[model samples]
Every structure is written in C-alpha cells, then in structure tokens.
Target: MNAPKLRWVLFTAAVTFLIAVLLTSFFKEIRKVDTLAATLDKRMEELVGEERKTQKLKQDISYYSTPEGISRLATEQFNLVRSGDRIYKIEVTSQDNLQ
Candidate 1:
C-alpha cells in the first residue's frame, strides 16, 4: 500500500478506538448519576416523613401548653374532676357470686 493510504487508515482506527473508549466512560458516568438521583429521591421522601412527624409533635406540644388541654389530660390521666361535677358508681354481681 502507498505511505499516505497507510497513514490515513491508522489515523481512522485510532480515532474510532478513542471514540469507543470515551462513549464507554460517558455511559458509566450516566449510570452513576441515575443511581444517585434515585437515592436522593428516597432520602427526600424520608425527610418529608420526618418533617410530618415533627409537625405533629409541635401541635401536641402547643395543645398541652393550653389550660383546656391540661384539664383534659388531668381528667383522663389522674381521674380528677373540677368542682361542681357529679360522680356516680355502680356495682354488678355475677350469677356465680350468688351460687
């Protein structure tokens, strides 16, 4: 073959190899970016769930700081009642007790 023709063939082969290598590298980088994006989406969902829990806790804290909420907690937890409230009690006996 002529010298010029041989040089041209060599240059074309080199360029093709270089392009193949670059495309492979770029495909790997694209896959890594996609994986990172999926991970970020999952982490964002977890953050949103935690934020909701924090908001609920804040609401509970604010309610418990009020007089009405305090009164309800005292009544339910301690069975204590305010003045001017009436109390009633009932007793039941089973058939076995009579026997």
Candidate 2:
C-alpha cells in the first residue's frame, strides 16, 4: 500500500479506538450518576419520614404541655384522681380457682 494510504488507515483506526474508549467511559460515568441519583432519592425519602416523625413528636410535646393532656397522663400513669373522686375495686376468679 502507498505510505499516505497506510497512514490514513492507521489514523482512522486510532480515532475509532479512541472514540470507543471515550464512549465506554462516558457510559460508565452515566451509570454511576444513575446509581447515585437512586441512592439520593432513597435518602431523601428516609429524611422525609424522619421529618414526619419529628413533626409528630413536636405535636405530642405540644399536647403534653397542655393542662388537659397533663391531667390525662397523670391519671393514666400515676392513677391520680381529683378531690371527691370515687374509687372502685372488683375481684374475679379464674376457672381453675372456681373448680
């Protein structure tokens, strides 16, 4: 083959290989970006869930700071009652005890 023709062929092959390598690298980078985006979306969803939990906790704090909520909690947790409140007691026997 002529020298010019051979050089032209070699240049073309080199360019084609370079393009293939670049395209492969670009695709790899694109795949990495897609994976990172998916991970970011998952993290964002987790953050939103945590934010909701935080909001609910804030609401609970607000409610528990109120007098009515404090009274309910006191009654439920400590079995406390106001003045003049009546208390009742009941007893039951199990089947084995009855037998």
Candidate 3:
C-alpha cells in the first residue's frame, strides 16, 4: 500500500492497543478499590461492635461503683453484717459425736 496510508493504519492500531491496555488497567484498579472498600466496611463493623462492648463494660463499672451496689455486694458476697448486728458461732466438739 501507499506510505501515507500505511502510516495511518499503524497509528490507528497503536492507539487501539493503548486504549485496550488502559481499559485493562482501569478495571484492575476498580477491583482493587472494591476490595479495599469492602475491607474498610468490615473493619468499621468490628470497631462498632468493639465500641459497644466497651460502652457496656463502662456502664457495668459505673453501676457497680455505686455505694448501694457496693454495699449489696459486700453484704451478699462477703457476708458482711451491718453494725451492731449479731452473728453466732456454733462449734461441734467432734465430727462423729452427733451420729
């Protein structure tokens, strides 16, 4: 064919090849972006769950730090009696005596 025509054909083919390469790279970058976004969403969900647990634990700590709660815990858990309340002790002289 003519030189001018051949040059035009080569230029068109080169442009088409470049376009294809650019499209392929663009698609690969899009997939990477999608993967990154999904990962960020998953991490955000985990952070939200962790934040909720932290808030719940803080609330529990605040609840237990109250005077009434402390007193109740001391009374029931430690068997602490109020002031002037009497407690009796019973002792068995021998383990087999009652039997």
Candidate 4:
C-alpha cells in the first residue's frame, strides 16, 4: 500500500534520527569535559595549598638561618648573656601585678 512518493518521508526520518544521535554524542562529550575540568580544578587547588605550605616552610627556614633570628631566639628564649651585656631577672605574680 506504499506510494512512490514515500521516499522523501523515509529520507527525512533518517536525517532526523542521525541528528538526534549526533546531539546525544555531543552532550556526552560535553559531560566528560565538564568532569575533567572539575577534577583539574580540584588538583590545582591542592597544588596551590601545597605551594603555600612550601613557601611558609621556606620562610621559616630562612628566618632560622639568619644571625638576627638566632640572636633573638637566644636572647628571648634562653638566659644566655653575652660579653658587655647586663642581665636582670624580675618575677611578678598575677595577683600582685594588677593595677
């Protein structure tokens, strides 16, 4: 019961199905790209955090390697007195120091 003019209808249906399949494949690729982008962003943030920690450690190392830092630590932390320097000790209780 098919007519000779039904070829056009079949061609249109085929084209529509191909376009639908192509659109679905394109969306899947987009989803994969989005997931990769999110993972990369997380990794970049982790790297930044590690870099910040590394920089802090480097600053700390630099500070400790200097003479002034060492001198300050020795003078403030330890009761060591150098030559030509006067040392004095004073103790104050919390209750008696109140103004």
User: What CA RMSD would candidate 1 show?
Assistant: 5.1
User: Model 2: per-residue lDDT, tens digit, 18-93?
Assistant: 9999999999999999999999999999999999999999998999999988988898899999889888878887
* TM-score of predicted structure 4: 0.63
lDDT of 1 by residue, 1-99 (tens): 646788899999999999999999999999999999999999999999999999999998999899998998898899899999877777998999887
Best by TM-score: 2
Tell me how many clashing residue pairs each candidate has: 0, 0, 0, 0
Candidate 4: tens digits of C-alpha lDDT, residues 1-99: 967578898998999999999999999999999999999999999999999999999997899789977877788788666689987778768965686
Q: Per-residue lDDT for 93 in model 3? A: 98
Against the reference, the lDDT scores of all candidates come to 0.94, 0.94, 0.92, 0.90
Native-referenced Cα lDDT, model 4:
0.90
**TM-score of each model, paired residue for residue:** 0.72, 0.77, 0.68, 0.63
Worst 10 residues of 1 by lDDT: 1-10
What's the TM for model 1?
Answer: 0.72
Most lDDT-accurate candidate: 1
Q: Tens digit of lDDT per residue, candidate 3, span 20-82?
A: 999999999999999999999999999999999999999878977999778778887999988
Model 3 misplaced regions, further than 4 Å: 1-4, 71-99
List clashing residue pairs in candidate 4: none
User: Model 4, stretches more than 4 Å misplaced?
Assistant: 1-4, 71-99
lDDT of 2: 0.94
Q: What is the Cα-based TM-score of model 2?
A: 0.77
Tell me which residue pairs clash in candidate 1: none
